[model samples]
Target: MNIALVTGSGGLIGSEAVSFFADKFDLIIGIDNNMRQYFFGPEASTQWNQDRLASDFATYEHHTADIREVSQLEPIFQKYGTDIKLVLHTAAQPSHDWAAREPFTDFGVNAVGTLNMLEMTRLHAPQAVFVFTSTNKVYGDNPNFLPLIETETRWEIDTNHPYYKNGIDEYMSLDHTKHSVFGASKVAADIMVQEYGRYFGMNTGVFRGGCLTGPNHSGAQLHGFLSYLMKCAITGTQYTIFGYKGKQVRDNIHSWDLVNMFWHFYQNPRPGEVYNAGGGRYANCSMLEAMALCEEISGNKMNYQYSETNRSGDHIWYISDLSRFKEHYPTWDWTYDLRSTMTQIHDSMIERLAVTQ
Candidate 1:
């Protein structure tokens, strides 16, 4: 049987992968313990999504197993054996602030968990394609030091700089900067993913994603940038903008688009190849710009406050340079733009809130 194994199978990217590959793969095995709730709070819990997946897909098998525990993961891998054709590792401690609070938990989940996944894939399903959802945070605070210009609403790179046109690419240095506890953990995992591919000759691909936002995201204040912002806009909750005059720009890529990138990479099976993934120049916004768009979409002015202190290791203006990925996969491109994505988020949030109410 052709099985697709998705870690964090209830979260944004993981759930999207399950849905996208449902018809293609014979069976979909999911591993998730809903650690998100522990990392954030109950509001950030992915239980609702987990239940939804259970009810939606018969092909999907859910396991409340922690990725950090090899004993838990080994049984699943051993049960599936070589039938698992795809291993999409989307689980991680994905917050900069939360990571600082619990360094051990963060490292165990992000770094050790990733290592567990890589080693398991190597031992059990060596031929399966492994796709890791890495983040732009691996570059640390390097992007913040770029020659950026302040505009009326957002921060932008200098017009004359090469990155100004295409945004930051894989060539940017991942050294000599404060990477925060979360970023540092991710960097460890990111490098290992590449090493496994290059050294072991495993079929692995790493995508350093920008703001991975979608309707399915369990948006929290510390993470889920666009999702959480739109949630605040819809619920009339006060949203806080931390530092950089709220002009820190991030390119937003829909979860489906990112999963689609994974699909392409799986088909081609590039070993140790890394690509920058995001909305790129096509779909991006500043914090202020995002708030304005959220207001426009929800038809409610966002309740927001400003803070002088910015999150450590945060970028000022970082739009992904998708030129490399585009050049690699000529057929792949973004399907959702910023406005369309935000509108979907607004609509979806309304639907979900109504259901809960």
Candidate 2:
């Protein structure tokens, strides 16, 4: 049995990833400093995931150390050494608006933190498979690239796109020239992840993901995406919808779906591969469309208001052209539909609130 390490184990993605890999791997190493507090204030979800893991998972090492601090991270990697088979680097300060305000901490956590992970991988687990969770934001404000049309529910690139090809491909320009502080940071890390594979010949892969959503989320109003939307609907919290007449689109993939794919890549390591991990055009939805679905599930209309101005670096119609990832891992596909996903997020938020209240 191979040992695996996951950074940011308290995050929405990291939380689900830890539970998913707990029994599967011989030993699991979960490191989290709860540094997401820098952006989301005291309302971060780090402790929730940590508590869940403490109950269910055994044969795991839980470290509360910041990845940005190299001294804190290197020891764990060194101890594991060749025993560690895979390293899933998911820890980062991921917030567009927050990144804009505090670009220093954002760069330090994402760009510098990633650099430290690479260094650790090179020093200790030289042959280990490195899987970096990237964002579609690396492509930046891609709404300008397409001829977007707004519908009652959602936005589409065209009336009839081939393969429902309403979204940007990996080949679309990453040279985004507007509101791109967050984009620039992630891009730096994304390229470095690939570079390590190419220049250093490390077994690394990059997943430029779109709207990764699921149940085990902290569900912050500003960032948690679908979970936050569900929280807004269920908790009757005021929610803000920015721009595109609330018809901006995103392909929402469940956390389990993405984590499963990450596992598959770990089992069958490929050299320096970059794949867009998302639900594709068919599963895509707009802000209003998803809110409607949430309302349908929760039996309440969303307490939401739309702002005329768009958020910085927000995509108008961005779904993944997942053909490349599909071709590589033919069996890798998402099972959850938009309706089901919204419902799941609603239920999860409800459950979380029951305990908190």
Supply every candidate's count of residue pairs whose N, Cα or C atoms clash at under 3 angstroms. 0, 0
Enumerate residue pairs that collide in model 2.
Answer: none
Q: Residues 174-210, candidate 2, lDDT per residue (tens digit)?
A: 7745637887899999999999999999999999888
Total clashes, candidate 1? 0
TM-score of each: 0.99, 0.96
Candidate 2 minimal-lDDT segment of 10 residues? 159-168
Instruction: After superposing candidate 1 on the true structure, give the runs of residues whose Cα lies further than 4 Å from its correct spot.
Output: none
Runs with alpha carbons beyond 4 Å of true place in candidate 2:
160-163
- Compose the digit string of candidate 1's lDDT tens values, residues 168-196: 99999999999999999999999999999
On a 0 to 1 TM-score scale, where does candidate 2 land against the true structure? 0.96
Residue 221 displacement in candidate 1 (angstroms): 0.5
lDDT of 2 at 81: 91
